[model samples]
Target: MQATRTDQPSASPVAPPPPLSLQTRMVLLSYFAYFFYYFCRKHLGVATPAMVNSGISDTTIGWVQTAYGVCYAIGQFLSGALGDRLGPRIALTTGMILSGIASLAFGLFPIVGVLVIALSLNGLFQSTGWSNSCKVVAEWVNPVNRGKVMGFWTTCYIFGSIAANVVAGTILARYGWHHVFLFTGITVAVVGVIQGIFLINRPADRGYAIELEERSSPATDNTRSGFMLMIRQPAVLLLGLAYTGLKYVRYTVFSWSPYYLVSSIGLAEESAAYASNGLEIGGILGLLLGGWVGDRFFPGNRVRLALFALIGMIGAILLYRVTSGTGGLWGNLIGLGAIGLFLYIADAIVSGIAAQDIGGAENTASAAGIINGIGSTAQLFSGIVPIWLKQRWGWDAVFISFIVIAFFSCLAILPVARKGKLTKA
Candidate 1:
């Protein structure tokens, strides 16, 4: 009773949030950051026909792409671990600036060896954007709305690829491949500066509580140990495994679709780039629809929705292969778009949403790194496999191989769906 007496501390009023406008700004910056990353990366694919025409061999191209893929995959592990330590803001800004420099250097030289070094470096820098963006999204968004939010955000890459094709197509039509690299590289660097100026690393930095309800967990640990801990979890490992196949197929599409259209389907080089937008358009639709389905129909169980999309992807890829030749231009567009839709829906759900749910706030970057890094390792094969299959068995076998992968990828996630709890890492 000695201190219980008269004077009670006055209750202070909690300040109100600055409005959704701030959140919108963060999301927009992140979207553009990723958009530019893809723009810098994918325009090279659009430029490949010209590069090949410039006396670069298909075998050389495969080697160059493999170099990039290897560096990109390895960079994912290193940057993801460092991102957790240094924060997304610094990591993203640094990556964007360096990637742009690398792309610019790639355009300045036409020699195969030099081009390989520059593009490989570009891949190394570009790898930082994925895990850092995942970390940023997880910190700002509540878990309850992560599916829908991430779905909308995932469109950046889809449309980025579309935009890259369109812009790179126009550039190649008018100026040539070098200008395409020069222009896109410069744009990415400028955007990186803007991101450094405006992007917030986390909601808590602005004195706001994260909107998601916290799950029970122990105290936070250091980045290295935490990363190792998260990677060991069964959910993370399975998700990563499924992602490997998904990325293998998707990267094949992104890297080779334009070339296929030009070489096999008989479209002009420029026209192939434009037509390739069908894949991205399909991706955009799939991501939005899939996100809504996950949130509205299966909020507590996303793995089921992912499985459905995977099954649909197998059907879609087969349909695309069947109709690509006989379906006319519009049929090809529609079929390619359908393939994009199915493949990306599964990608968005498994990589983005699952990582957020399973890894929680503390491990989002680590999980993203593990899943995306492992998946990206498949890119090494994206070039190698296509080259081997096309060289030995032809494109028909390549498509059939992808179909087989889709079936197996679906099987990888079956246990996750059965558990019905993507959050249980």
Candidate 2:
């Protein structure tokens, strides 16, 4: 008696497993979506000086920057809820479209209030990028390949930031701020349509079982009374609070790097922009190392990977300080670029890789969203940090603050490290 299809052994060669090629498309689409999201998210920082000359007061402009963060926080809460239920594919695509519109509106009319609305709208949509990507990665890949795949996916932010900084700086200088917004808006729209058509929500949706069958459908049911259950979760709370300090460093570097160079280091506007791109390049390399280290040696140990990131971050900070203080333009370039690469790698591992480890597929988005939201909220200090430090003492205070925060971020993970949990068993 031959075994039927239903009775075929899990190891049966004839039964044929699903191709992971769809998973490959999912990764590419998901990553490119994030790449575009960051492009939209980051262009404003580059355009700040331009906005200032357009009759907006520096103080008022700072508040405008804050608007992006305010919206980002709201996006964190909403995107996760949507991804957990509606599925990542829809959530991510819709977000790209919404952000595309807001980006255009912001470019067309540059009013602070209107731009705030647009940023909020953009934030709302942009929130889904990470969450949806997490869902795609979680559903299709398993423990063994997750580190490398996710690590590769993690490079997109640096790549996105590098492209935005280089392109936005040159373009804004040549074509003005409006053109930057218009170009990014169109780019994001194109990415959105392409990803939506090509990406599937889950492996099952593409007629495939999970790579390792990570979990069952009913078991993935994480629906609960909104934030109530979420807050109660230890892992969730830790994810948010720990990352808040980390965000301060991340946003401060991004939002203020240009200003730091121009105001403190005495570099020209475009030069500062160029220096900042160095950070993104370092980020790309760091992420590559992060993934390899995480999967190869540590295996399922997320905290260990995070700890390794903590060490890299310290080196990154030293470079940031030395480079920013130096008079040579080349020095600034090397230092700032190092900062961008290492710091970004640290974050990529934390949210993109670690969060998925803790939450699994069903709740991957929710986990990432909360962590990202908490970090973005640290931008509450983005404007004030520079102003406060400048007024109270000096520019050195800002760098010192980042150094302290970097250590604190590492120390904050004591709890996470103590409990060595794995997604599998």
Candidate 3:
């Protein structure tokens, strides 16, 4: 009977593991979706010289860019609403497939009218990538870490731009500019199919129920009646205003810097493409630092970091202007890198991090659409503004205008910097 007595060991309670796979997959799919989107968007910058050689005037090319910008801005609202309603999987996959077809068509057709139409369609479809992807990422991530998370996530644009430049430049060297478009198109189409097969629309879609548990909160009261209410929040309005100016300067560089190097600074076309890569290369650092600063120093207050970035951008633009005149190739390269660093710091903070803070998971797509749509509208003027100024007042005026825009953009966010702090999860 004594031998039969036995004791059992006690067991401690165990908590469920975190949904790391959900976030990992969300980040990867969204990253590649936006990454390939740039393939269609950026080829125009590399192909401008070829376009000019084929009889497209600089003004005509500007108009073509404007056409894309106008359509893209409008499409942002539509596609964003659709993404919110239909889910990311459908919106993004459809957009990519169409954008790929459009890119392929852009390469095949050399006629100016036809090319304009193709680029416009490409712009429309490409608009789907950002807002939908934003919605998806917002659902899986918490606001407390959004700055750091989105900071790294936003690098897709920088890396995508760099990759497009290298690939396009290499193809321009070996196979020709048309092949650049062809290669990128095929790549985008392949990525689109992969995303469609693998991308989950949200945490709830895959049995992760955290979002559902939080549905009782006010932020998740995402009915049509509440949509406008959320979008009109002070953070959204102020960030949107600041982003307009920031996006103008960003698009100016993306649209015409290579052409400026070739025409004003006398670099060869391929060299200009390679040099433009420096801007994005420097942006990688800016984005990482911006996220770190926002998370570490400001926490929920992203406007403070954005204000700093805006000031830095003004100085960098002025320095780059001077470098263009006297610093020679290496100097200009360094200057461009600095400008990119500062510019994207502001962009990653305001456009990527702040938008998520204001929108939350439920309203993120709409918020992204509204802000990005308004910001992109500046592209309409960005295409025409610098070109007109360069034609009349010279490159000095063109650079000065960017300084003025940065000054105002900094001012736009000051009130938010003083009054707002983003909420934690």
Candidate 4:
């Protein structure tokens, strides 16, 4: 009766975390690199009011954003492949420097045609940041702990958005809007130079052999075969479709919320910019929680968690629409926070964790690029359609559209959720 069970196998040992110094270096580098990427990207949104006041129509400004989105979407595919081939270190540094130059051009020449061309170039360069940074993380970190690691790491964008708004708002208040672009461009370029000097592309470069999960694709290098292989995955395609709706919702909020506050709520320009921080603050929390909960509770099933978050996002949008008119500043802030929390929970899972899991070690950047590229297409409409809706049917129509988009985003993943996990096809 007291005999021990000798035939039963013991549980497998959990892998130890990556080397502390290497992990720290990778995390900090990727975090800051992507963080400054936002500086060049988000400054346009902050400076929108000044642009409008300078006799640029809202529709024209929307078209400028649309131009940026188009090029950004196209660049995702090319940059993802480049990251895989040339190494993320080169791709990332080049993108940052070039993006900075583009921003400078946009600021120096504020004419409509120049604004379109500059922002378009900026969009293309800005595309390099995410996929390459993702490739670096995939190389340095093991998949077992990737969810938690990427969770905190992904907050770079959220924090970047917050910082960009604060800095841009302050700069706009103190100096003219032109200074916003000049300062951000200079800052990002310097950071790019520093990142180029210090970034280590992979663990092997540092003489460490980190264990990685094997993927089904043999051509995992930054080659055409690998790109095709990743694009063919059903999960990747589904995730991309879902991300389209999600990105539309996110870009709309990011691009227009300040305008909404100023125009609809009667807030001053500076106040509108500062209040927008509430969204990013909630996003930071969402990403952290999503990463922790996905790894701790769901393990390999990030899509399921993402589905839950999508549903929550739908609810938050609805709540925001209902209360925004009567809720005042506090109400708007609360709604924005709630919307950010749920939206980003789905966002981080779909674009970051799930993409990593599906792509594994080999095609990390390609998978991310494909998914994000598809999602970025929504930015085209996000930039222009909100303006159309607001002009034609008012703000309520715009939010109603977001609610519908969030619901469809949730539905896009239902088939994958039924399969019960994210896996390569």
Candidate 5:
């Protein structure tokens, strides 16, 4: 009996770490892909003031943005399912290339109707970036380290936004607003081509052992069942609801902060664009900290950490509203940075970490799509609501409304926080 112990060992051998070279390559490529995707998407906001100066009404711009939001929301659902079916490499490559084309078209014709149509197409293509890119990370990274990994990985957007501001701002100041789109559009298209050539979809494609358990079966292989499976999960629904509020605030800030600085605080367009970078800079730090703390201390739990950050977000928004106009540039910078810090911690956790946890390897992209889709529906309101509020009440009312939204966002996740921790579906 004692001699039959060959199969029973004192301990299990640890799996070797995933190949660092492959992981790093995938991460860097996806990071830059999404990074430039923001360039095409965000330059519109930077150019809005110039557009207004050229005789466009706030209402017209709002409608154009609303069109983009509608298309983007619909595309999130479709692209997510497609990513699952076709694989991330194809989905991501196609999206980035098309988005660049749309952006270039927007710059070529300055008509309001043309702007509406072009940005709508741009929005649809832009929707493809996040869910598929997240899917890529989910496929390549181990679940055990996903929080920390995605934490750092999600910074692509934050830094992307910052870079877009700097680049777009400088271009607007020197060449013209039209050149902003032309330059960014060409760059993202090139990046997409490079990614299509080199990017691998999964570790197994290259003969490495898959790090996460893949829960795929023929029963849940199709789009409808995968969507229903995610929707049925209580955590997914609650996270989606919570993400709606967070995204509304985030997008509103992205779309309007530069305008606010220019119109209200008396800053030049380029200066305002540079100042807006404070938000993303703060976001970079917050995302990194949230990922590290959640992975190291909370382990499988992310909701509780997000709740704390959401509460902090409420206070930060209040501080930003109160100090921004009175405190001058430094005050405005500090306030925006503070809001960014808290908002992104919660944002990264709910949108990235929690979605991955619930979706596991099989349904990661679909789950991201559903959650982000629901959240993106708020973009419809984000485009019009602040303009409506600011027109009717004042900028103070805009801030107050978002404060209420932040509070409700906290409420949405409270039930999940009480239950403690999520496991793979």
Candidate 6:
């Protein structure tokens, strides 16, 4: 025999991963990024009443809200593209910077024209939020464990809202609303800087494996296609339609619940503020359930979970109208909380898991952004819907309009249900 076998090739030892893997760091950083994003974003919502007291008309206020919605819609689509092509870290950090600037601008200029312009800027920039979060979560978390991890991560929305309320309430009570903007802007900016330093785009970017074990599927990563590729998917289109209809109720609640309580239901300002927590609390619960149902009950049937969630949301809206004015302050608070809880089930499934199921990973952000952006376009109509009803009818008229819109939202999901079926795990 030849002497070739005398020397054996040596194998390199594998390096051990750090105490916190890249995925762990990325998850933590992503939560921070989104937490601050919500803080800056929700400030506008809490301050709307104060804005009204500053001389803005309800219609004008609605218009200002519309400006944010319009820009946010655009941002959603564009940021999805950016997230797919450039990576979520860059897209998200850029959005944070933009939102922070918008916050500063909102505080600096209290004029209607200026406020509208600034809010539009904020909305457009922050459009990056949802797409970026989707990309980040998809990157760091595995499919199997994603349900629970996402539950923890998505809780940022509620915590962010709570932060805004606590900070806004105290500051607005003492220093006034402008300070709320100032504090929000400053704090969010600081968090943004930290995110820029820490958040990595994917496990591969830093040499690690994702945490969850997903069902068998090809990878969903890359920047391979254009906007048209995203729009062409039937799943994207159908899902978008359902979501668009659904948001009429969702955005309405976000934008106007406080005003609705204070003006129509006759609750004290502080009481309305506390009651507002109901929405966030309910949302937290709903999202948790949605994730569980998607994993266990719906399992392979992610879309079915979405349909059920949407159904629950419709029921919640009906409950909202029925219970809103029935008992008094306590009743309104409890009713609003229930709405928050039930409505968020759809929110978690449709926007979170369903987006991934239909769109796949490579174009996930883009596809999801387009769908959610289009669906969220209903925010514009919802913005004006209440005003029209109130101008013509009264608070009662507006509440009736709420009922009608909720009913229409229920109808929108029928086609979606027809198209997609859930597969059990």
lDDT of each candidate versus the true structure: 0.83, 0.73, 0.80, 0.85, 0.85, 0.71
Which pairs of residues collide in candidate 2? Answer: 278-337, 279-337, 279-340, 279-341, 282-341, 283-341
Model 4: how far residue 241 lies from native, Å: 0.4
Candidate 1 backbone collisions, by pair: none
Candidate closer to the true structure by lDDT (higher is better), 1 or 3: 1
- Model 5, residue 264: displacement in angstroms? 0.5
C-alpha-based local distance difference test score of model 1:
0.83
Off by over 4 Å in 6: 1-21, 211-222, 408-411, 415-425
- TM-score for each candidate, following the candidate numbering: 0.94, 0.89, 0.91, 0.93, 0.94, 0.88
Q: Model 5 off-target regions past 4 Å?
A: 1-18, 214-224
**Tens digits of lDDT, candidate 2, 192-263:** 888778888876664566645355355435644323445556765665666766678777777777766777
Candidate 6 scores a C-alpha RMSD against the true structure in Å of 4.1
lDDT minimum window of 10 residues, candidate 5: 216-225
Superposed Cα deviation of residue 186, candidate 3 (Å):
1.9
Q: Which ten residues in a row have the lowest lDDT in candidate 3?
A: 207-216
lDDT per residue (tens digit) for residues 1-425 in model 4: 89776987999665554588977898799889999999998898889987788888889879878988999899998888777767889988999999898888877877788788888778899999998888888888888889889889989999998999999999999998888989999999998998899998877676666788765655544344557877988888888889998889888877888888899988899998988887888898999999999888788587898899899888888888888887777788888899899888889888877877887666788889999999899999988899999999999999999988877888888887767656643
Give per-residue CA lDDT, model 6, range 111-176, as digits (tens): 666777887778887788887788787766666676677767777776777677767767777788
Put down candidate 5 lDDT per residue, 221-291, tens digits, no spaces.
54446667887888888888899889889888888888999999999999899898888888999999999
Preferred candidate (lDDT higher): 4 or 6: 4
Counting clashing residue pairs in each candidate, in order, gives 0, 6, 0, 0, 0, 6
The digit string of per-residue lDDT tens for model 3 on 152-197 reads 8999999999898888888887887788778888899888998899
**lDDT-best of 1 and 2:** 1
